[model samples]
Target: MSAAISAERQHDLDTGAAASTHLAECLAVDFATLLQTAARLPVAAVQRMRDAASKGITQRMALAATLLREAGQGDVTHWQSHPSDTVRGWACYLIGSDAALDLPAKLQAMRPLADDPHFGVREWAWLALRADLVAAPLQALPLLLPWTEEASPYLRRFACEALRPRGVWATHITVFKQQPEHALPLLDALANDPERYVQDSVSNWLNDASKTQPTWVLDLCARWQREHSSAANAYIRTRAQRSLR
Candidate 1:
């Protein structure tokens, strides 16, 4: 975003309304603009833009995909190890979004991040799980599953959370089903996740799993009843029922 545009966006956010009517009524932009906006803003501002970008991409899967193409040119050497975990992590995910980028190189960039010591970076790890590296669950299963055992609860939680069935880099259910067991350990680690976000994400995973492996979810209900309680079981059970329907 240019300084003028950033100033305008800042004003719109402050006023809580789109300022388009006065500025030629531009409704949306390409992904690059969306990311550029996200990169330029503070965290609070970026959250809204990130959500907007996620929705926009969902609605326009093929349209701004070119933005993903341009993301590969970023110099990750400076970004990959940036002190601000948020910068390095998000940059990695953006790089992952570009399907044509080198997966091996991307993996090399992420390898250090996989074991990142900062909880803040660990939290965003899931956000950075781009599909380009693991179109199939089996391929990403080993890479993703091990994080569940990390001592940091944040990393453990995100180990499963990254494979979220929708939005950002991962929007495919086919990959989740290919290796149901791949999610098993992560689920176990997250069953008692302290964070509500992580807990809700666990439900989302089951909701997704219900589509591919009802037996596994059913077994989960049976085994976890003593621990997860009737309510959590009900949530998982409802997800199962919906899957069957």
Candidate 2:
């Protein structure tokens, strides 16, 4: 193996040295530092972090979300910063739940950032939210909905994503049942939005909801089909295929 890879492996071994009989240590290393290092660490370092999941450092989990989001810096950035807190929140949510980045405020922070002027922050929040938006997206969703009409396509795109499934961590019956009316307008606006990201987001929402509320989702598809809302039909069809089945 290359020296770089070897060094990384050594670092992980040291940090994760003698995890407990529990297979993880008792949190002696500077977990925050480990997280920062983990972000820049070679892939092997990251794998070590994953292996150390048993150690259960809450801070590292948040760092992992940032690291994962910032990993490649291109299309990853695009998907990462789509215009909502969905990604960031969900990513944070997943990490939080898994015992890595356990901050309640991290998910809460995504709310106001949802209206951020910069697409990067907005996208970060949206993607992070995907980790757990359904459980408490209301904390942020109400704030994001108004922005759906924002002049910025990025903001609008993320707003649409506030409703998307992958955008949120997991689906909640309340998510579909509670906001059906409130989300309806946003759905209509985004159902055939001109921006591919925005339209694709709406498609994902309906597609995911299909599993929980297929009747509404099929009705939505039927309604969209009738209004010549073909803009996202192909994209939605492609994206929603598995969900539909």
Candidate 3:
């Protein structure tokens, strides 16, 4: 199956010409269940589905996610570990849809997704959780703090990625943009991480923060260089200073 969302597949979904084929690939047996449930939906609800056909892929996914959440049908947590990255990605999207789960529950559910074997799954985990964190930065900070000290590099990276001031493809955390110091603990933990993946994200986090607070980021990099001037730390510092330089 395709890892990336395919234009052709999205088109098929929009036109309803390949509902069976698209559903076969996306939800398979679960598609039949969705159809059965959708059939019983109110006329107004069915009309909403028809209207969403002209909307984008994300909207369609959000509608499905809402229906699944309302019906208490799909086990998104279970789908998080699916063999297909595409399925796993959608599962993550479902997790992010609206307030289906409370903040604590959402954070708990995101733990496994952050460390998923598939890189796409890991990315989706960040996309799925960002809005909640951005909405309640303080609540999220405390919950994510522990992840910094975790053994898994992926989890550690996720702590930084999800909290990035200007994260890619997700709403920015405005509070962090105003006070980047809030994420110091997470960044401090991975300042010298040997793993490139973790270091890269840490650098991006710093770079994102630098956009709002250049001097602070510069000072932090200087201090990191003063305290830990290893090659890995130097690389991180360099990347972190890219925007500033």
- Per-candidate Cα lDDT values, in order, are 0.52, 0.52, 0.71
Error of 1 at 222 (Å): 1.5
Candidate 1: misplaced stretches above 4 Å? 1-55, 58-73, 77-90, 97-128, 151-154, 165-169, 227-245
Ranking by TM-score: 3, 1, 2
How far off is residue 79 in model 1, in Å? 5.2
Please report, as a residue range, the 10-residue window in candidate 1 with the lowest summed lDDT.
18-27
Task: Highest lDDT: give the candidate number.
Answer: 3
Candidate 3 lDDT by residue in tens digits, 167-192: 88678899888898887877787888
Predicted structure with the largest TM-score when compared to the true one? 3
lDDT of 1 by residue, 196-218 (tens): 54556677777677676777767
Q: After superposition, how far is residue 234 of candidate 1 from its true place, in Å?
A: 9.0
The deviation in Å at residue 20 for candidate 1 is 19
| lDDT score, candidate 1 | 0.52
lDDT of 2 by residue, 1-55 (tens): 2333345543453343312111122233333334334235566646655666665
TM-score of each candidate? Answer: 0.53, 0.50, 0.75
lDDT of 3 at 135: 88
TM-score of model 1 relative to the true fold?
A: 0.53
Q: Which ten residues in a row have the lowest lDDT in candidate 3?
A: 27-36
